[model samples]
Target: MSAPLSRPSYAAVLRVPRARSTFAAALVGRLAYGVVSLSLLLATVRATGSYAVAGTVMALFGASTVLLLPLRASLVDRYGPRRALAPMAVLYAALLSVLAAVTWRPGTPAVVLGAVTALTGACAPPLGPTMRMVWGELVHDRRLLQRAYSLDGVAEELLYVSGPVFVGVLIRFASPSAGLLLSAALIAAGTCAFVASPVVGGLRGSSGRRQQGKSPARQRGLLQPVLVAAGAGLTLSAVDLLVTAFAERHGYGGDTVAWMLAALSAGSAVGGLLNGAIDWRTPARVRLPWQAAGLGLTVCAAGLAPGPWTLTAALACAGAFVAPALTTAYLIADETAAPGARTRAGAWINTAVNAGSSCGAVTAGLLLSHASLGVCFAAAGGAALVSAAGAVVGARGTAVAAVEAEPVPEAALEAESGRSGA
Candidate 1:
């Protein structure tokens, strides 16, 4: 039984130089993405003078991400992150520059902008998933994986919180194009640095398989925990929308909404740091419940906040659970995925979150347009409760046992990995 795969100590994992680099790369890449996202929204609005059209362009970008992400995951799985990172980063940078240039010209057709945006979207670097996969492969111990995930989650929150603010400030004081251009440069530099890092380049896939004279084709599957995590992601999306609407309704203007959102991200950053600081001896079962409770509390606080400041505090508290939940999900997914299918599983999680976000956004918009803000808050709180319930349920099952029974084929794993690494 491989000694039940005892969890590795936290200190042992932190000592890994590669893990540190991976985390740094993830942080920078995410920050760059945040800047680009805000810049794109502003640029589109500036160019078209139509919020509706700007929204459409952004939606297309999301659609492109949803469609192409899986393919990107496949490439990561097959070729490793090092091999595929550069092209994607370069292409993303190039596309962003093109977007800035075309938007600079007066009378640049919206159709042309939309087409470029979609094509550029395809170039998005699969940094998050690839990093997660690499962490899983390189870290080995389950406890280490949890810590890594916790840190990654925190970085994600920080990026979303700070990146947009930076972009917004730059656009207001400098030029909107500056934000976009900076985003490109950051992505290019970060991606290249990650690829060239000794830890990433020196690592080889399937050391165990090679020693045993087995081929890489021997690994692939459905990873049940990831699927459950994906479901939970849907719930989180719904909650996010509810919170946003609730803030807007309570006399919090657009700026307040941004701050409230940032509060949540900040909380996530805290959670991630906490995860990394904790001892690995703690069982996930115990840790997961506490995380869920935090999430529930966040919702309740957000729903009941009497003023904008109070609501922001509540949102931050709620946000603190974000990394823990993500850590739980990523750990589960890593355990359940077939060796080569890790990236796909991660990408699927991303897809689920995006889908959930889309649904939540639409629902929240409709509700806010027609109903009171309190109702939106209540709805969001309710959705968060659902997520908490799901996490509770997930905690009870073994990572491998929580997933579907069907096994993924080795060929499929290879194919998907290859596509992701590309």
Candidate 2:
């Protein structure tokens, strides 16, 4: 009989110098995103008295960010982190301030607000992907990198779960603007600190790391996994919207929405930790499709839940599969991309996620007007299944790419550090 593979330790991944500080700094900025979006949506609605208008405004922000993510990633790759992120962070914070001012003004046109929001989102740095790139730079071992990605997923889930509650409290006790203001402050502070941190590792190296060709998006076999990730994002956003719809349909309090969302995120965090600890011998290509399918099936079951508690439980179950699927997607993306294009690859995943979420929000809104809640849940399931199909179809290409891609050594990385503009 074959011996079992041992799992990687989270501690091993974090043992590198400056890892904790860099991770925490990036996390602050990421947490701000969770606060800003929903808070902005809610504030806009409160001011405009139109859910449609608010949603449109928020969607524009998400859309612009999705469209600009690759460009931003490319910039980061070419110019390095300090040059790319520092100015962008300042501008992003300034724009958020502008947004908050405009939102507070009564009778402000939604169109004008949306335009500003779009521009604001465009200015925001690709912090999440950039942080992952930092991880790839810092963690030399492939298994350690995998664990880092899992930890990233868990941190993101925690942020999404807690950020809303934080914003909710501020909105209830103080004002909706408070959340926006706080988010802006966090981004401004976090981005500057994160970009300037010595712990971010290095991006400039001449160890044959630089590629002289088209970006990863244009590369073969990259598009399908990106699309699959979009499907996963869509399902997640759909579930979020459905929870809101379910709360409103049943006349549940606003806090109920927070609890439901928290339940989902909590489950994801748990799953991520568990996933990171496991030593999976199977390739991501083999695991992703099954994980996505399972996520869909679980979410589909949520529609039939009889009560808030039941729905929360079902959503939690669905969330358990999310991090594993996302981890697989990231792995596949890294494998399929060119050496120099890893940052761009990570950005593509981020773009796909935002795009899918925006699309899901729109779809859920339409379904709520026409179909039953249960039906809407099934639609989310359908989207997840579609993602599964995409993953299955593209798995072979990524697997082949993985076999060909070589891991850069830690010594080579450090040697190249001095050459980085950052």
The model with the greatest TM-score is 2
Candidate 2 local lDDT, residue 301: 93
TM per candidate: 0.80, 0.85
- Per-residue lDDT for 76 in model 2? 80
Clashes of 2: 0
- For 1-422, candidate 1 gives per-residue lDDT tens digits of 01123454455555675666666766677678778888888888777787887888898888897778978877776666777777899999999999988776456778988999999888898888877777776666565667667766666766766787798678777667678888998898888878777766754443234222122221222223333344345445665676566655565667777677777777778867787667656666445556655676567567667787887887787777767766776675565567766776777767766765676667666777776666666665555556556655655444444344347877789888885445
Candidate 1 lDDT for residue 124 = 92
Best by lDDT: 2
Once fitted onto the true fold, the runs of candidate 2 whose alpha carbons sit more than 4 angstroms away are: 1-7, 46-52, 107-111, 172-175, 205-218, 245-256, 368-370, 397-422
Candidate 1 residue-pair clash tally: 19
Q: What shift in Å separates residue 403 of candidate 2 from its native position after superposition?
A: 9.3
lDDT for each of the candidates?
Answer: 0.69, 0.81
Tens digits of per-residue lDDT for model 2, 58-77: 77887787899899888887
